[model samples]
Target: MTNPVPKTAMTMREIRHQLGHPVPPPGVPDAEVLPVRFVVSSVPEGHNARHAYTINVHYRGEGMYSVGHGLAYADGDGAWSYEPSRSGEDDEHDADGLTWIAAHRFELTTALRLARRLAPTLTVRGRSVADVLADGSPTAEGTQR
Candidate 1:
């Protein structure tokens, strides 16, 4: 039977449910998008006289991620701060400090792609992020510097 409601009329949650995506528990407001919680820092290692910066990837309920507003770097004065994206609302934060919304609440693959573009040397337990993703275990704790 065809669905009576148009696809556009259905909420993302409803659409996801119909498509067999995981259904969030009752009363979870705006559970459609997942945001990353932990912060991922990008350190420039094995580079020639390179500066360092940080990028926080908040991991939402699923394998979804919300990349930070902009790269966090030390200014000329050497104070660390977020550059803040030129695009508004690129970095929305919730009460728990997670980015509320991003240009894309990227899944694992997409998130890794963005990470690789920015932090190619990002590694967990000395393994490349790609390798980690290949093994179906991207949840390894970010090694503390």
Candidate 2:
């Protein structure tokens, strides 16, 4: 019996199938889908406190010359950023176009789930005043936090 495929491999395969693209053979150009995570942090100097949020999602498709798209979930919000930007190359434009559409659909389900969890945290705080300089540089006296 054949060994079970690794979860990472399975995920890649699922993404390819979802995009309706066949797996490429060795030495041939193939498309790839990857799950990616991005974290955003707030850092303050002279203070020990820090806050970070990691966002995880899939980035699929192929290279610049091949038709592919890279997609990711934005940090904390569950919104997806779909990259449909086409690199003007003859070999991969068609494939990339198709992949772009596929990636957008792939993120919808995940985004909805994540959004629900994040909705409660989105609130605005009152504004505070700060100083500025005419040359777009902060004055030395205003540097103190």
Candidate 3:
């Protein structure tokens, strides 16, 4: 069996690049971008400690964005789009004008439910929720209390 990709923390800049979001040039107001914090932890289940995936999703925003999670497509020229779809057809899950801000808001139902469990515990030092969330991991920063 193929080994699962090891869990490595990724920065917003890196994740954004992978998700087809715009990466501003140096000194170009990059702070305005919203970020998505995701982790897919492996939990041992059943006998012999086999691993099961536990996905975590966290983000901070004004709650006015759209996220599409589905199949992704690319043409011969390399341009591509991704949207939620259970059907297997080109243009079946197509979307347009989605921005980086909106992408962070997108969460699968299960992901959202899991996130809510952890969300209450994420605030730190009276800072902006977005800033705390953007710091990237729960253990990365937190208050002693």
In model 2, which range of ten residues has the least summed lDDT? 126-135
Report how far residue 134 has shifted in candidate 1, in Å.
33
Candidate 1 lDDT by residue in tens digits, 1-145: 8878755578888888999988888787664454445444443342221223335555754566655424443222223345343444444433223332333467766665565455544443476544433554312243322
User: How close to the true structure is residue 28 of candidate 2, measured as C-alpha lDDT?
Assistant: 62
lDDT of 2: 0.39
lDDT on C-alpha atoms for all candidate structures:
0.47, 0.39, 0.40
Candidate 2, residues 1-145, lDDT tens digits: the string is 9998876546565688789988665566665454343222222323222122223333343311111112333333334455556766754876876665554433535544553454333222331111111123322344434
State the displacement of the C-alpha of residue 89, model 1, in Å, after optimal TM-score superposition: 17
Q: Which candidate gets the maximum TM-score versus the true structure?
A: 1
What is candidate 3's CA lDDT for residue 52?
16
How many Å off is the CA of 66 in candidate 3? Answer: 10
Q: What clash pairs does model 2 have?
A: 67-92, 67-95, 67-96, 68-96
**Candidate 3 lDDT, 1-145, residue by residue in tens:** 9999999999777788899999887667666555565543322222121111223454545433222122222222222245444343444333322332344344445445444443333333464344533544334124211
